[model samples]
Target: MSDTTQPPFSVLFVDDEEISRNHFARAIRADYRVHVAQGADEAIDVLARHGAEIAVLVTDFRMPGRDGDDLLRQVAHEYPQIVRILVTAYADKDMLLQTVNTGDVFRILEKPLRADKVREALQLAIARYAERETRQQRLLAMSETLGFLAHELNTPLAAISLFARSVENDVAADYDPERQKDIGAAARAMLNNAQFCLTLLSSFWATVHKSGGQQSVAEAGGREVRATRLIASLLDTYPFAGAQRDWIEVDVQGDFVVRTMPNCVALVLSSLLSNALRALADVDAPSLRLEVVDGSEPEIRMRDNGGGIAPEIRARLLQDPVTTHAGNGGHGMGMIFCNRIMQSFGGRLGIESTPGEGTTVTMSFPGPRNRL
Candidate 1:
C-alpha cells in the first residue's frame, strides 16, 4: 500500500500544530504533492485558491474555530470530489462517533501516525476517488454512445413512420369492409412495429440527451409517487395489462407513495412489467402480484404465478441476456434496462424462480427519509 505508484495528486494536510503538520507533510514528501494548512480558515483559503488540484484533504480531528469534523463537513459540502480523512491526536469517543456518523470522513488515522500508515491511507483515498471518477467517466461515455445511436435511428424512423401513416390513410379512404380490413391489419401491424422501434430510439435518445445535458444533474428533493397510480395510468395503454391484470384484481390503488423521479421509475417498471407479461404469455392462470410493504425501505415485489423460467435460464436471467421468447425478438434488453435503472436509483433487482412453479421479481429502495 505505497503511494509511489500512483500518479501525482495534490493533498491538503490541515492541523493547528505547525510541528505535526510539517511532520506529516515530510512523510509524504517523497510521493504526493502536499499543501499544509494551519487551520480551517487557511484550509478554506487554500481550497478556494486551488480546489481543482486538491485530490485529498487530510485534516486533524481537533482544531481551533472549526474542528476536524467541521472542516470535513465543509469539504463534503464544497468539494465532494476531494476525499476527506480525519487524522487527529484527540481521538476521543465523541470525535470518533461524529466522524463516522457524518459519513464524510474516508478514514480516521490516530495520533503518532507513521509514514507507512499515512501513505497507505492516502493510497486508499486516492484509489476510492479514482474509482468514483471512473464511474462518472463511464457514465458520460455511455451518454455519448446513446446520443450517437439516437442520431442513427432518426434517419430510418423518419421514413418508416411517415410512410406508415400514409398507407393507413389510403386504406381508410378507398377500401371496402373486407378489403379495408386486410389492408388495415397489415398497416396496423407495420405501424406497431415502427412505433416500437421509435419508442426504443426515443428512449435511448432521451436517456443520452438527458445525460449529456445539465438537467440530469442529481437533484435534492422529494415527491409523492404512488406505485398503484403508475400502474393504473398504464393499464389502459400498457400492452400486457389486459392479459396479466385480468386474473388478479389490482386493489392497491394508493397504498404506498415514494419520493423519486417518476420518469426513471417508470422506465424501470415498464421494462420489468413488460418482461413479466412476455414470460407468462402461454402459461396457465397467469397472475401478477404487486405489493408495497412498509419497512426500512419501500420494498415492491412484482411476481407472476406463471410457469417459472427453466433452471438453466433462471441462473442467467438477469445476469446475462438469453433468447427465451422468439416471437417478440427478445434480446433481454428489457431486463438489462430494468436492472440498470434499479441500480442507478440506489436500489436492487432480485429474482426468484422455480423451474415448474413461478417467477418473482423484487425491487427495493430507501424509504422516504422516515419509515412509512
Candidate 2:
C-alpha cells in the first residue's frame, strides 16, 4: 500500500492517455503529492492553481493538441522554478535529446514507463528543486546582513567626519604656515575617507530599500542623465589622496545619456576606482583614464595602467565572487555586483586586459531611445 502522509513537495503529471496518467500517478502518489492532467491545456490550468506547491512537472511528448515540448517551453518561462521532465517513447528519443540540450527538459522517461524509473526521476527532480530554494534563501540572508551592517556604521562614520573637519579648521587658524599645511593635509585625508565611507553606506541603503531585497536594479527607479556629467560628479566627490587625483584623466568623445539609478552607478564607479588605485599602488607613473563614447550603443570605459589581471583570474572575476586580494579583506563581490547592475539595465560590462600592459573596463548601455 502507498504511504498516505503528504510529502514536502508536489508533482504534476500530464499525458493524453488516461491510463498512462493514472498509472504514473499511482506509481509515485504514495511517496509524492501528485496531480494528474489529461493534456497540455489542463496541465497549464493545474499550474495556474498550484504552481507554488508543484516542484516537478512530468509530461508526455505526444499529446493531441499541444505537445509536451510546447508545454515545457511555456512552463520554463512562467514557472521557471519547477523542474521539468519529459516522458516519450523510444522513437522520439532523438528529438527529446534536442529539447534536453536546450535546457527545457531535466530528465526523460521512456514510454511503457517502469515504476522504479519513475520514482528515481522524481527523487532527483525534488532534490534539484530543494537545492535551488536553499541557495536563494542563502543569498537573501546575506543581502540582509550586509544592509544591517551598513546601517549600523553610518552614525559613527558621520561623527568622525564632523571631527575631522573641525580639526582642519583649527589647524588653519593656529598653526605656523609650514605646520598648518602638514596638519591640514592629515585632517583632510581623514575627512575624505570618512565622507567616502558615508557615500558607500548611503548608496547601499538606497539599493536595499529600492530593491526591497528582491527586485533587480532595473526595477529600481531612475532618471536619464548624461554619462560624462555623472562621471565628473563622481570624480569630484571621490576621496583621492595626494597625487592620486592628478593621475586620472577624463576624455569625452561625445556625451551619451542613459537611464539608471544614480546611487547604484556611484557605488559601482567608487568600487572600480578603489580597485584601480590598489592595483597601481606599486606601479610606476600609473594612469587611469575615463572615456565616454557616443554612438548608437553608448559606452563608458575606464582604462588603468596598473598591473593587469592574468587570464584565469579575469575569466572568473565577472562569473563568481572570487577575489585575488583575499588576504587584504577583498570579498570579491565588487565586480559581480557591478555586472548584475549593468545586466538589470539591459546593458553589459566587459573587461580587456593584457598582463604588464593595462586593463580597460567598458560599460555598454542601451541607446537613448532604449534607455530604461
Candidate 3:
C-alpha cells in the first residue's frame, strides 16, 4: 500500500534544469523511489543500470541535445512495459499525436509542472506500470505451465489410453457376446478422455498465445474465420467430447463470418462447452446445439439442454466472478473473459434460460462488413 512497506518503486525524472529536477523530486520522493537525470544521455545510463527497478519514466520534452520524444521512443521500443510521461513547455499537435499514437507516451504535462498535477500523473503512471508487471507475471506463469504440460499431462494420457484399450481387448475375450459392446463402450470413453486432454492442451496454449508475444495484441482485419466452422470443429474434437458429443449438433442457417481475433471466440467457446457438459451431467436427454444466424447482424448461438442457472447466478453472471462450481475450484474468470472478448470487438454476449429448461448463449458482433 505504501512505498515504506515494500521495496520502493523507482521513478526516473529527466530534465536539464537542476532546480526543476530537485524541486520535483522532493515533492514525490516519499511515495516513490526517485532517480533524477540531468539530461537525455544520463537518463539513458540510469535506465541501462536500473531498468528492472525503474517502473515510471517522466521526462521533460525540448531538452538541449535529444528531446523527451527521443527518450520516450527508446523506452517504447526497449522497455515497452514502462509508463512514459512527457513534460513540455511548448506544444505541437502533430508531435503529441504521433507520440500517443505509437504508445510512446502515456500522459503529457505542461512545462511549468505543478507538484500536485505531477504527483497525480505519477500516481496514475505507477498504477499503469504495476498493472503491466501483473500482466507480465501472468504471462510468465502461463508460459511455465504450458512448457511443462507436454511432459506432465501427455505422459499420463498415453498410459491411460494404452491401458484402457488393452483392458477392453483382454476383458472382451472372456466376457459374454452381449457384454462385448459394454467393454468397447467403456474403452471408447477412456479414449475420448485422452482426446479431450490433447485438445485442451493444444487449444489452451494456442488461444492464449495467439501472436506469440508477451502480450497478444490482435490486429484489425484478421484472417476471416467462419462461425459454423469453429463450432463444428469444437463439437467433433473438444475437451467436452464424450457420450454427449453425439448429442451436440451444429446448424448454419446462412453464410456468416467472424472477421476479427477468432481465437478469442474459440477460447470462450471452450469455456462454455466445459460448463455445458458439467450442467448436463445430471439432466436426462442432454443435448447441445450450435446455430449461426446469417443476416444484417450475424449471430452465433450456443443452446444447451441442461439444468439452467439459478436466479442469483443469472443476475450477476457476467457482472462479477460468481460461479456455481465454487466447491470444485471454479474462479469464474472464464465467463468474465468471454464477456470482455465480446466487448472488445464491439459485440454483446447475451444469456437467457429458465430453471428447468435449457440455456441459450448468443454472441452478436457489430455485423460483418460488405454484402455476401
RMSD of every candidate to native, in Å, equals 12.5, 14.4, 11.4
**Ranking according to TM-score, highest score first:** 1, 2, 3
State the weakest 10-residue window (summed lDDT) of model 1.
213-222
Cα lDDT tens digits for candidate 1, 161-182: 6657766676668656776666
Instruction: Report every candidate's CA lDDT.
Output: 0.67, 0.77, 0.73
What's the TM-score of each model vs. the native? 0.52, 0.51, 0.50
Instruction: Using lDDT as the measure, name the better of candidate 1 and candidate 3.
Output: 3
Cα lDDT tens digits, model 2, 1-372, are: 344557768999999898888888879977788999999999999999999999999999988998998899899999999999999999987787667866478898998999999989989999999777755643543453364335334433654666576676766686577766666666675676677787677767765576564543444545456777678877887778778889899999988655555445656677777778777777889899999899988888889998899999999998887876665456666777677666655677899998998889888887767653
Please write out the lDDT profile of model 3 over residues 1-372, one tens digit for every residue. 464574458899999999999998889877888899988889989999999989989998778998878888888888888899988777555577776767568889887888999989988998888777656644553553344344334443765666677676768586676667666766765776677667766666675666453333333335556787778777667744447777777887975776644665665676677777777888879888878898877888889888888878887888787886665446565566677656655666888988899888888867656311
Q: Which pairs of residues clash in candidate 3, taking residues 3 or more apart in a chain or in different chains? A: none
Q: Model 1 reaches what TM-score against the true structure?
A: 0.52
Candidate 2 stretches with Cα past 4 Å from truth are: 1-41, 44-192, 204-223, 368-372
